[model samples]
Target: MGTTHDEAAGPRRRSLLQAAVGGSAAAAAAGATTLTGQAAAAPAGTAAAPRSGGRFDGESPRFALAVLPDTQYLFDADSADPDPLRATFRYLVAERADTNIAFMTHLGDVTEHGTEDEIELAADTFGELDGKVPYSVLAGNHDVSGSDDQRGDSAYLRAFGPDRYARMPTFGGASPDGYNSFHTLRAAGRDWLVLALDWRVSDNGLRWAQRVLDDHPTLPAVLTTHDLAWAEDDGEARLSDNGRRLWDGLIRGNDQIFLALGGHYWPPGRTVLTNDAGNDVHVHLTNYQDRYYGGAAMIRLYAFDLARGAVDVETFAPWFLTRDPERRTPLEAENVELTGPADRFGLEIDFAARFAGFSPVPAPEPRPASDVLVRGTVAYWRFDRAGLPGAADEGAPVADGRVVRDLSGHGNDLTARRLHTSGDGALTWSAEHHVGQPAHASLRFDGGQGPDRGALLSTRRDAPLNATRFTGGYTIETFLKLPEPFVGEHAWMGVLSWEGRSGDAGKTTGWSTEEPTCSLNVSPERFLQFVVYPHVQDADPTSWSHALPVGRWTHVALVNDGRRTVMYVDGSRIARNPTQRSTGIATLGKPFVIGGTQFAERYGQGFYGWIGDTRIVDRPLTPRQFLTPYR
Candidate 1:
């Protein structure tokens, strides 16, 4: 799906997430890279992380690291340019936030006036994260703003490298560097919990958060710090302020204190409430320095899933024109219902070392210390997006000979289409049929987060192509949802992508975008989802995720090794999308039958639902090599 830079203009397609495993199949028709240039280079290909947000392995040992609270950016009160928490710090440098993420702390001020160059550009962008995801930082009050601002506390300890108090390696092991320490960490596999509370200093982070939750009363603890304790018993010395009697003695004595992340308080708390020995706690308050990129119009994606026992909340903002609609509305908090059983252990995963290694990749950032390119030209507007010829007016293939011409999308059906759902929402489409069948435009419309119906037959492209230097290695396959028995189905479907990092449709762009995607569903229980992109703002790569379902369909793929992203689901493999800033030129607009624009008027948001027997192939396939070519 990559055409439309004006074969006469107006139906645009181009956002296969910028391809390498998929769109680079042309690399802008032979130039190798230069759809235009927003640059920030580091993915000429390889070291992975660019497939398309989904999977990073799981049988349920469970893994996550999308945390960012009390994070700041400011920009210029005393010299602040933290570029608005660079969109959740590019999701903590492309997620895994540190694999089972038993590490990652910030309940500090990170920036308000924490100057010294906004604490060294937020400690060189959190030192570019990805040590699997290990991190550490603390210094709120806008990074030492009180006590008469102790002279900017030595520029927030030489730029957030750590000071106001140290110690955070499982807490007390091999280091002696912590602000209030006590760590035990092992991660998804087990061991759980760690505590790094220093709240500047007073009541001194509740006696090391009560000797680190009395030495882990049943595991899973997380009491990093910035502060939260006001239930009005009038303690008022501020900071952890007694955080409501240490959150009611760790919520009537532990279910593992749940989670209480905080920041320096900007538009902080709105309500996290949870009680009755259900023990689930949540205070998570954030927004500082002006609140990065789309600059604090609100931002918090939050989660806590003991295998779906529940606990999920959302609160995005940045459609701009703000002054407070509560920072432009959008506080969707509801679905945290998994109810019972969710501790699977991701299955000791050795799968013989995952079928034979190929995982090691963490040594890059040491090249000449900063090319400083994340290239610029945002909000650019020069649409030649594809139709380029000049080697003497080239133009003639594409009658439909299987597809492939590159250098900016080119004529029609660029390849790729599939979507099917039902549970009373119906949706189908795999075009021209044969290979698993489809041609109904399928259907889905239940609403409320699912069988929330489906339907996608893509060809207009637009999955994130700002126009070139689009790095390489790309792929995308389909089929997932495999499992039926719902003449009255219950909702779920798959296949939908956008990677372009969309924006515009009511306006908003404070940064952070992976662009609404979805795939592999129909689970009585089985997982793989990309429903991300909103570490606080920046969205509009195009969008896809009609709720995916249709039972027993199985198969899914995405392999862009530009910087991290590799999600498969049937041929096994699951999740990974690490830092891929789209290259553009992959559309699906207007109603060219829902994707051709200039008419349907709503492309990126409506297609109805249904897909089957589709194909976007060029690479990444392997469920016995895509069922041995469908037998």
Candidate 2:
């Protein structure tokens, strides 16, 4: 059985039933008992807003999972009021497209009593989501007669049995007793499992859950139940006795179970536990029945951003949102959204690495040089040959004076050169490369300012690339990642640039005459800056990009189609591309440099990051022709 707590322990917990009906008294008096009662309360002849159907984007890297917890207080047998719950359902249905809500899961305690009247009302209210959103529900202690899934023939089971979800695409299966169920939602290009377990699951139920895990061994799972944990005033949650039992019998042993959610306890909280596989399992308890207006039908949205490897959680009361802001009471306004640490927060999980044990994401193999040698390719340099017989091993210092052959057959080979005062460890070979990069290795630069220390690879004094200017157009592509704690001293470091000064090229329109004719650099704020001095025009057209996230590999491309320049990061065109004409690059007969910029023919600092395969083309190429394949 779920742990019982006082619903009205203090003045703050007193019921707001009367206050909630202040302006909507006429609607409350109408006593409309259907799921659409809230809509019926609207003006005559107006139909309820349409629900979002067939709008979910399951393959999006970013999506949301809606969680409704403990609506028991709103479904009491005689005082039943389904308006609040209906309002929440409407909100989820309307925002489904904008939020990319893949699925909804109700943490059980759907009614105040185990009576047929209450369960029936609750079930009817849920009809608002019947065909629109896929969801799962289970029996709470309040909705069952006895303490286990084996307890037969309850109102909750009769209303939410396998028959209720047999037609749903996400429904996987239900236990024989129809009290425990599992759902498989296709999201983020993969299948995810949601286990809706009874408040008191029997040993037989646990065995059934194990079988489900065995059937789909690769799907990450979220275990949901009614009774799991209780939180203290400070919002630190501790597992209840029943929760401990579930952990021991089902969750802790299953490597695929990464998140566990429950709602029987008040004062929502969360904690992290280590499973037998030594992976983290996030255990969360969310419930607000003790709050004003029976918790106001609050819903929690877990926004999963796979690219960022994080889940942003937000709790808000949709019922309050449906109310008029100008007529809302102070309490109603306060309950609209929750910003407390325990209620709203973010969880970071490296999805690929976390699921690697069960579903390993294969690393892309290095592409052949011939594959990326697109038309008009002038230069292509890749460090993937590291660990070869004559090359530096992974993580080993790049030897001074080592030569890197240009794969384009352009005879523009580059040679590694260490700064006069820098140490041998200034640069090293790294096996870490972008997931989509053609190469599987990169070069790590440990350069810094204040003394101008680092190593760089530069073309020979007479290399053809240093003298040829792309009059028709040009494309420069490179995959790079900034250090996690990019220090202040490493600000304004250069990733790649031409070696000659703009002044030397006779082009004076630039941030500085001493600066390079063309350069790609990281500003102090980590913004990507692409500046070029055009040969046909004296104006320097510069393209600035949003701040790049540290510690994540990014593919950057600068495409100039003879007229204007556009910068693309990870295949998406940035908003700050310059409109000024940029016909051709101004060049001097000097060595082109990578890993550092030159000011008046002097290196101030080398790049403090990892640089992967780089390619330069004399003609502007589409994203499909870039080294890193665009998705």
Among all candidates shown, the one with the greatest TM-score: 2
lDDT tens per residue, model 1, 1-631: 0011122234444331111221321222232332111112233321223222333443244445334555554433555545434434444344443232234565666665656766766676665543434555655555665542123336665554344223333444211223344456664445556565545544544554566666555565666566563211111122244466556655435545556665544333333455545433555444322323423323333333443344344333212211121222222111001111110111122221221221222323211101211122111110011111111111211121122122222233333232233232222222111122222111222212233333233334442321222234334444433334434333332234443333322215423222222122332233344332222223322222223344444445554433334555444454344354432222324211211111112222222222222333323334444321321
TM-scores of the candidates in the order shown: 0.23, 0.88
lDDT of each: 0.36, 0.83
Per-residue CA lDDT of model 2 for 518-608, tens digit only, reads 9999998889999999988998899999999998999999998989889999988999988898888898878888899888888888889
lDDT of 2: 0.83
**Counting only residues 3 or more apart in sequence or on different chains, how many pairs clash (N, Cα, C under 3 Å) in candidate 1?**
139
Model 1 stretches with alpha carbons more than 4 Å out: 1-169, 173-181, 184-192, 195-207, 210-247, 252-256, 259-476, 479-615, 619-631
